[model samples]
Target: MDDVSWKTAVESRLDFLQRENLDLKAALKNILRENENIRSEFEAMKNILRKHVQDTDEKCNRNMKKSANKEIHTSVEDEFGIDPERDGQRVARIVPPSTSTISSIAFYSYLSKNSGPITAHHTLVYDVSHINRGNGYNKNDGIFIAPVSGVYVFHFSVCIGGSAYASFEILVNGEVIGAVNEESHTGMGYREGSNLVVTFANSGDHVFIRTQRSTIGYVFSNDMCKTSFSGWFLTN
Candidate 1:
């Protein structure tokens, strides 16, 4: 082979190698740019999540403050007596106590064990009596007898197992006032139901909870979830 021909082939190979190196560099640059974009997007999402959590915390704090400030004490003048300046005549004005006193009556009871496959018109016996201030609640019979004639507020909560449905009725002197129903259709879990009722009762009126219709599964009562009943005298 001639020297000039060999030198021309060598130059042609060097030019091809240089072009390949430039192409590899361009591809690497593109990959680095894409990585930067992905990193920025991830950071932005993290910031959004952080802001949401912070807002939720702030909202909870504000609600707690409002609850704490709901009850406050007043002076003796605010408790009784009428303002003659407003009506030009004397009228009686009496303010109730802010907290529960010795005269007030309240009771709270819960089921210590689970009740199973309750039928229609079955009574729920809350065996564990936590607070029976006036001895109005009977743990054995699941009944609350009003100790004094007044307006009363009653609350009850019931939890049922998954894949079942149950309905309960709050009774005052054998009359239904309110009802609670819980239904779970899907997987194995727990569902809860609660109801509140306000009624006027005499001193001997009876209040209780009973099953409305057929119940599919058992009621749940455990450390995590409790079936409870409570009542308090509101006003006379």
Candidate 2:
């Protein structure tokens, strides 16, 4: 071959290689652009998921806090017999013994006044008398001497105030038949507890209530809330 023919062939080959290199560069640029777009989309999705989780957590925490506070408030109301909407304290229910029978042996009495700071083993003398049909309960010594031999139902309630506690025992002839314990744990307001006793007694058996263990606060009594005791004959 001649020198001219050889140089022309070499030039043509060089041109072909340059075009291929350009094509390759274009393809690489396209691939880099696609990778950048994919990365941006991935970052956006991550941000959306993170925000959703944060919002959900916040909402759940708020709901849980609200429910917990409501439960606590309800518990306090029920325990203390407080009616928050009426803004009045609920009085304890005191149903007088049924007066159906003409010969019913029943009595009802209450403190009617605040008595307090009583020592342990002190007898609670219910100062006021509402009923003593059989003439058994003595307001002076707070003792009920049975007027007739029969089965009796006795109930007593004790109220304590001012962050203190008191324990009492309903005694029959100097024996503990039932017990009560009341405490005002919040250092304010009052707390009350009661118990009932059903037992047989002779005509002269003595029944009374007295402090036991300890007494730390004042006992409360009034028209709204009364520390009281009562007993009725159930049967012979």
Which candidate has the highest TM-score of all?
1
Which lDDT value does model 1 have at 79?
44
lDDT of candidates 1 onward, in order = 0.85, 0.85
Question: What's the CA error at residue 217 for candidate 1, in Å?
Answer: 0.6
Candidate 1 CA-lDDT value? 0.85
Residue 107 error, candidate 2, Å: 0.6
Give the residue spans of candidate 2 off by over 4 A: 1-102
Worst 10 residues of 1 by lDDT: 70-79
Model 2 is weakest, by summed lDDT over 10 consecutive residues, at: 93-102
Q: Compared with the true structure, what per-residue lDDT tens digits does model 1 show for residues 1-236?
A: 79999999999999998899899889899989999999999999999999999999999999887665442212322444335345634454565534446256999999998877889999889999999998999999999999888799999998987778889899999999999999877685888999999999998999999999988878888987998999999876
Q: Report the lDDT tens digits of candidate 2 across residue range 1-236.
A: 89999999999999999999999999999999999999999999999999999999999999999899788756656566555545666754343223344256788999978877888888889978899897889999999998877799999998877778888899999989899898787656778899998999998999999999667767888765889999998865
